[model samples]
Every structure is written in C-alpha cells, then in structure tokens.
Target: MRVPTPRLSIPDEPSLALPRSFWKEFARKNWDREPRLFRGLFQAHFPTLEEMFAALVDASERCLRGEIPPMRAVRLYVEHEDGPGGIPYYSMLFPLNRNHLPVREDGNAHAYLERVTRWLGGKRFGVILNRAQCHHWGHWLQMRSFLSGFYETVGVPLAGADSAVFFGNYRYTPFGIHKDDWHIFYFVVEGKKTISLWPFEALSQREEVPKEPGFIHRAGAIHLRDKAEEERLLSQAQLLEGRAGDLMYWPDSYWHRAEPSEGLAVSASLGVAFRPPEFVGAVAPDGWPDRVRHTELPGGRDWRMPATLRTALQQRMGRKSLLALERERTTEWVRLLASGAMEGAAPVLTEAPLSPHEWLLGSPARPLVSFPLPEAQVLVSANGHSRAIPAPPAVRRRLEGLVERLNSGAPQQVEALEEAFFTRLTARAFSRRAFRELLDELVRWRAVRRCEPPASQRR
Candidate 1:
C-alpha cells in the first residue's frame, strides 16, 4: 500500500507551480561546476504582483505608526550613479530610519512613500524590506508553506531561511559585483532584471583584482574599475534576464550583480541556508529528552552554562574542528548534487487559505473570551512529565485589562481591541501572526471563547 502524502496550503488565485524537473536538471549539470544561469524559469507563478505592492504600501504606513519595529522590518537605500567605476552608490545603510527619506517629518509616511515611489519610477534608487513574514500575515503563510514544500521535495535540512521584498527602478543596480553566503531563490513580481555572473575562482586569479579583506561580507566593484579588467571579465560572464513571475536561483559564493530593465521593478527573494546530512548532527542535534528535562530543569539550568562551556571548549580545542567539519560537509553535498543524488522529488500540491490580513478583514469581529474565572499567570505543572510556560508580561496585562473591561458591562469594539490594545502594545507589535496564534492557543485552553457581534452590529 502507498502511503498518502500531506499537502501544502498554497494561495489559490495566484497559484505556484514548482519547476522540480528544471531544478533537478540544474543540480545535475552545474551543482559542482562554475555558476550558471537559467532564464524565464517561472513566468506564471504570481499574477497578483500589483496587489502585493499595494499591500506593502499600507504596511509601510502601519510601520511608521509605531505599530511595528521599523528598523528590524524595513531597509531603505538611496542610490546615485556617482560612485567609483560609475556604479551606483548606496546611502543610509542597515537599520534605516525616517530621516533617510526625503520627508521633513517622520510622521509624514504618505509623503515619504510618494517620494520614494517617484524616485523608483525615475530609475533613481530602491528599498528593501526584511522579515516580511512578521509584517504581512498572508505573505507569511504562503512563504512558510512554500518553504516547507521546497525542503520536503529537496530532502535537505534547512538551517536558516527568510523572505525579503525589494522595490527598485529601471536600470538600477543597488550593489556592484558581490556574493552572498546563502543560496537565493529570486522571484520577480514586476518589471525585469538582468543578472551577470562570474566564477569566484576566475575572478580571484586576475592580477588586477584587489584581494578582499577577511572580514568583508561582500566584495564590491571599487577595486575592479579598470576598463581592461572589466572587459576581460565580461568576455567570460554568463548573462540571464528575468521578467515578472520568473524564478532564478543563485548558489552560495557565486559573484553576480543585477540591474533592472524597462520600468520600476518589484521582487521577492527567499534566502535559504541548507545543512547537508553530515553537518546536520553538528548544527541541529536530536536532544528532545534533554530539551524536555531542561524545560523541567529548575531555575533554567544556569542560563549562562551553555555559552560558558562552548567558549571553554573552543579555546581548548581550537576552531579548526568546526571549520573542517563545515568544509567536509559542503564538499560531500556538492558531490551528491553533481551525481544526481540530490534531485528533489515530485511535490504534492494543495490550495491554501487567503493570508491572515485578508481573512481577518473579511471576517466579522467576535469576542474570544469564554468565561473569565482566574487571574492570569505563568502556569507550571509536573507529574511523570513536567512543563512550564510563561505568558509574556504585556500579553498577561492585556488579558487582565480585557477581563476588567468585560466585567464592567461595557460593549467592546473589535476594531478598538485590535488597534488600541494589540497593535499599540510594543511587544506584540512585531508580529500580528504571533498575536493571532496566541489567541488560538487561548481558545484551545478554554481561556477564551468566540463571541459573535449582536445582530444589529453584524455586517
């Protein structure tokens, strides 16, 4: 008997079809060779790019209201074509603030957005928003489901992964030639981008190329300005152009650069850090027994013990072991891929619900509290099994306040509760999804009940 496979919840209207065979072929051909490029691989995956752009604009407004942590969620850069070698130069590095925009006051988010959009339309600069999962519920759900499907299909252990949205102008290349440490899956939502890639080994061997510093995260084009050097490299470069809905993958350490063509460009990039089977033991060990007991471990097992022990071990044994282990694992994985052993299996597809933001907007507000009985506190229990879970102080306080408001016989407005209470709370502001998850857990624990609005107020 064949075992039934579980399905992923992907978006319905703008459906996605994974190019499993293409990816498998890619793995077979260039897994261990120099960097390669594939053009127009997924030109029909996302058709709602405009809608997503509108959602991003609204999210940016919410971010300015202190409803979210701006710095951690968004990055803004102004690019000018005046840098060395005539490449675009970046201003306002990481952790961007309102001051980075052209607006006079931080409160004028509308103006800031308008100016930024205008700049992008004129091929002036670009912006990047990180951790998009925290800002948009629907986007987060789709991304999580897609990632799950990708990992299951590929049969690789994911170390770390994240989604970021980028908005730029035509002919804009924010960064010069550089390489990232993580594999990237680039999805174009609007406009087009041309990518040029060069092998790291080939670039490193050129006498005119300046040596990169050990601590530098990305090597830029400042050192490769000579026309002779640029021409020589271009002679052997691989070029790929991608349009809206197209998907492209770039392996780690592949030196490449991108420039938008035609009009304003908008795209999403999913960065993935994979752990080969051999490295899985070092990176993610199976310690469920210890994990449970440790949670049961009284007083948190001297919170600093793990770090202190790790420091001591590293000093005594040297960092060579960890480095060598990583190198060996990477090589092994590359060999498997080159030998056609790492091709992803055919995936099982399923329809996913609309994102959280869309669902909540369409659904009517209802009271989630069932019957308030006791004061809120961190709960701890022990038997043959022991468990301890602490409620965040802010959430506990909010629950208590909700109970008070309900007991006073005042009618509660759902909109007020979401915006005034949940959104305004700094701790909860970082993630709407987490706040909603907490509500679900409360309902399951009999701490809250779904109360519908009166017939007169129902929409």
Candidate 2:
C-alpha cells in the first residue's frame, strides 16, 4: 500500500464531520455491493449501556497490568517503522479465562472498573472481549436481549455466531494499513475511530500526482528520506475520518487502518466471521483420519516391543531394551511423517486417508488472472459430485505458506503475508470460501483489516 506525501504538513487537525446525506449515499453503495461488514448495526443494544461500559473498564485495567494477553494471553505487541519519534501503543484482548481470573467479591464489576480507571490516569479506556470468554465475565447473562436487537435490525440470523466485542481506549496509536477475515461494523458506542481506507484495486492502478516534499505510498509503501515519493502515492487514496455515534460501513475487501486521537473515547462493536457448513469437516489433519496415521507420523516414541520382526530378531534385546527400541522406532516414524516426504518441507498431508477431492482429483487449474469474479465455477462433475479445481500453482503455493505461517503463530510472518494477499488481490478473490478460511487465522491474531477478500478471490 502506498502513502502519499502532502505538499504541506497539515498539522493533525480535529476530526471532520459529514452531513447525513453524504453518509446515506456512501452507505447505500457499500450495502448494495457488500453486506458482510456493514450488516448488524442500528440494531437494538446488547449487554445494556451500563453493563457494556462496566465490563470494558474492568477488562482494560487487567490488560494494562500485563495480567491479560492482547490477543489471547496478556502480551503487548508493538511494531516500529523506520521513522524516528515513533510511539508504542498497547492493545489488550478480552474474555480472560474465568477460571484464571481472580474471583472478585460477589463479582462486583463496578469496583474493578474504578481500579482500572485510576490505573489509566482516571480517563476512559478501550477494550475488546473475545467470544470464547465473554460468558466468564457475566456478559452472557444478558446476551439474549442484546442479540435479539442485533438480529432484528441487521436482518441476519444470529444463531451459531462466534463474535467478539471491540472497544477502543482513547490514546495515540498509528495502526498501519491491514485487512481482516470477517466483515466488521464500527458502531460508535462512544468516542471515534479515524480511519483511512483504500480500494483493493488501488495497488495496481498506482495513481499519479505532482511530486512534493513529503512521503508517498502506493504499490507497497516504503518510508524514505525522499519527499517526492510521498506526494504521488497519497493522491491515489480516499481518506475518511469518523466521529462519535457515526457508523462506518467498510466492504470486505477494502484496506483500512485506524488511530484514535487523545481524548475520552469508547465504543462497542461486534463481528461475525462465518464459514460454510461444509467446511465443518475435520480440522485439517488433527481429526479422525490423522489419528489413524498417528503411529506412522513422527514425534512420539518411548515404548514398544515388536516380536518376530526381521529387525527386531536381529537386535536380540531384553524386554526393557526392546520396549525402548520400539519407542524409538515409533518416534522416528512420527517425525518423518510430520516433516513430509520432501526434505526441508514440513509434513502437509496425512497417510491414513484423504477426502475424495484431495485423493483422486485435482483442480481444473487456470492462470489466476483468467478466473471470473464471485463465480469462478471451474469445478467439473465427476461421479455425480462437484469438485473444486485446485488454484494455479503460484496461488496455491502462497495459500500453502499462509496456512503454515498461521499455524506457526509467527506475528511478523502472518502480518506481512496477509497484507500482501489483501492489498494485491482483486475483490472477487476475497469472497471465495477457501481464501476466507485462510484469512480467519488472522482474525484469531486480533489484527483487523478494514475489508474482506477481494471479489476476485471469492468462489
């Protein structure tokens, strides 16, 4: 993504307000084209105003103390660019383990809220509670009414949704460009989230403008001492600033970043990241099929005694020794299978069995550029079943790397690869079920992209 340099350093100005008419038109277009991000706003309130605020305050205090991790564990993550005078900001994850949290007196949330307010300079704070732990903090007690209003307005069913509630504590933080797996709606419960969003296709267009003495970003922004680069890149982007009580509807594939100015700000937001029912099958290789191959896979080895085997007979060892030797053999098999047959490559397949598509058929591969948008119906009928043709080599390779990095839990690797995938691809690609599934991993990391995958990536 490119960042353009302004001919002038317009000092940080207060957020600008837009007329209702302007927003009405802007929102109508987004809703017509993509409903995933903009849906579920304007619905009835959930958790009640009082209950939501109290929980947010309690969670923020715990986050600042490092008692909770930002995404899962209370670990603070900060990324520093090449520029000087850069500041670090903290982000805390919500839904702390109920079992792990210190049980409070009668679970009085108000006292905990006060303790957090005093800790953070007595100003308001921000928070994001994950769905998994929402119930632990007494949030689920009122979830029924909260969701009822949400479903009524959004016109979308709320059943089986795994959601997270997000609130922003007012402080200075520069969140760079990024994308997310689920569609999100930013409802101003309080405060504001000033956002800058770019069209996914902007990367390929690389709009042109006069050179100036500042920074410019476009096709992959690089911070440099040169001013000429900054001016050209900024011209191609569309900038939007949001304020209190304003709802920002972002398309799934749009790229955006947000930073809250210094003030007392608060907001309640929820998002549903959905996957097809068909995808509910075994979780990759960890399910039933892989279990059958456990003995063959490498990693476990400690005890086993084989009798009447050629190698076992040659060894001629005692019972204890034989058991130890068997354990070693088992462990070796586990490691070999996990690491894959190709040296230097990790094991990516299970030997026990594979789904029909993976075992006997391959995708009707095509050049990535040729696939049609939102309906790349490349699948062919074989034995009365429809099968998805595999993506082209390069595309599949990139996705493969994404699946691996996501599982590895490497922050840097996940961020870099995801940004490239969202910014460089077309809108159709983002709407596809497979691509969306790959992106859901990033959602777990707590990094939100302002948009969904491009239409080009959708199936």
Could you say which candidate leads in lDDT? 1
Per-residue C-alpha lDDT of model 2 across residues 345-420, encoded as one tens digit per residue:
1101112321212211111110001110112222211111122334544454444344333322222232455555
Q: Which runs in model 2 stand beyond 4 Å of their true positions?
A: 1-29, 32-49, 57-127, 136-163, 168-175, 204-244, 277-459
Q: Candidate 2 at 334: error in angstroms?
A: 34
**What are the per-residue Cα lDDT tens digits for candidate 1 across 141-235?**
34544443354345333334556777655254465566765567777777787788776665665554557653122333424665475566667
For residue 311, model 1's alpha carbon misses the true position, in angstroms, by 18
Off by over 4 Å in 1: 1-26, 30-47, 67-71, 93-114, 117-123, 170-172, 206-222, 226-231, 275-459
Q: Point to the candidate with the largest TM-score.
A: 1
